[model samples]
Target chain A: MDAYEDLQQATLHDIPRSECLQLLGVARVGRIVFADDEGPVALPVNFRMDGESVLFRVSPASEMCLRLNEAKVSFQVDRLDDFHQTGWSVLVRGTSSYVESEDLPVLRSTRPLPWARGFRPVYVRVQPTQISGRRLVDD
Target chain B: MDAYEDLQQATLHDIPRSECLQLLGVARVGRIVFADDEGPVALPVNFRMDGESVLFRVSPASEMCLRLNEAKVSFQVDRLDDFHQTGWSVLVRGTSSYVESEDLPVLRSTRPLPWARGFRPVYVRVQPTQISGRRLVDD
Candidate 1:
């Protein structure tokens, strides 16, 4: 409808799994979506990529932690360009669980630090069953 | 554990509904969480606040549209400050439905335009059943 219609056409592209993992590795934040009593909820959390898994820390008393054990969850990370209105979003669908205490030290060193300070000793990890991504860009 | 532990404490504050709506009005991007066959999928969508509901356009053939009629959805908008580790998140849980043909004209004028190019004539609206928000900030 406008002059830049040609340039504004957002061509969608499917990103390969390798590239999806690469993007997830570089991202410092993502949203974890899981089913709750009411319905579904999404909350942002600082996360780190460990091998093929996504790891994050949460307070034991936090609502997010309470709802996340062995739950089927989706972790989403996206970068948006407001100026151009082009962006890429990666969605990882997996089952989430608490990381074993024996592996806490390794995870502590490798995990991205949480920006919000609290007693976030409980570690949660999502073992991805599927990883897919799409990019919207000017053709 | 760090020197700014005092400054790093995250204070939780409840954001009033009026302020939450104001914040939603300015946001250009938000994530829409809906029930998918695999699990709950959170996809980023550009949306606008219309009265007390959230509205956005989508292609009728898109997967998002397929799952959206009278479905329970959670639309989330949040802003994060990486430097200061402070931010606010608002979650709106509601029933979603396709916009009535008779109301499309008014919605077209008031709703935020989609960034993608297409015949996105299908308009979806989420009327909130419950709206709540919280702020995470350095105390």
Candidate 2:
């Protein structure tokens, strides 16, 4: 809904929440952005959607696990075609916490397998406060 | 250099600064992360390396243009091969500022053309305080 709306070449559309969740369900990798002491950092992780929450695993001793608990973070997933100059991006803003022991069993059934090889024993779930997405397409 | 270093299946190698810059040079798109009043935000941008600085353009009225000036931000670029489970990611942490009027002509020479169609007149440059990258490779 910015100045680009009137452009003749392309249009940016606000994607509906249901479609955003659908896209999130199909995407496996996304970048999670969070603030560290130094500044904000974005790291790509393999993730899955559990209802509306984003679930991903990390090494227990890594900085991500150390700083992400109870923190406000943003998770972004997108698919872009450089040749066609078209893409859609979904952003999820939420509070991140370690998955509870009681829910681990059920969560494990739909767990995301981290692409990197490691002992990713820590299961972090981001429960969203807001979810939105945008897509740019040729007019 | 975490627990994954000893893993037999895959290895995460710290990419040197020189190579990180090289990778950034070739990549046309990346995610820029910064703090908003709500929390951290990540958005994809078309960017290019100018010396060691990362430069990209945004609409003058966009939220990114409003908040990015003189801000501490993180820009990340990566290429992932899902089938092979190998990829490299480069992260640049820096302070952002508007490109000076006098430098616009020179900057415009190598300016990155944003794939999303719009009139992007504001050029922001991120001067890195630190640049680091990692590559996940098979053993």
Q: lDDT winner among the candidates?
A: 2
Candidate 2 docking classification: acceptable
What DockQ does each listed candidate score?
A: 0.54, 0.42
Interface RMSD for model 1 amounts to: 2.4
Candidate 2, residues B12-49, lDDT tens digits: the string is 89999999999998888888899989889898887888
TM-score of chain B of 1: 0.89
By summed lDDT, the worst window of 10 consecutive residues in model 1 chain B runs over B1-10
How well does model 1 score by local distance difference test? 0.84
| Candidate 1 off by > 4 Å | A1-7, A105-107, B1-10, B105-107
- Candidate 1 chain A has its poorest 10 consecutive residues by lDDT at A1-10
Binned by DockQ into CAPRI classes (incorrect, acceptable, medium, high), candidate 1 is medium
- Show where candidate 2 strays beyond 4 Å: A1-8, A105-109, B1-8, B105-109
lDDT of 2 by residue, A1-139 (tens): 2343344365689999999999999888888899998889899887889899999888988998998899999999998766676789999999999987576537454677777776787889999999999998877
lDDT of 1 by residue, A20-129 (tens): 99999988888899998878889888888989899988899978899899999999999877778899999999999999877654634576567776677778999999
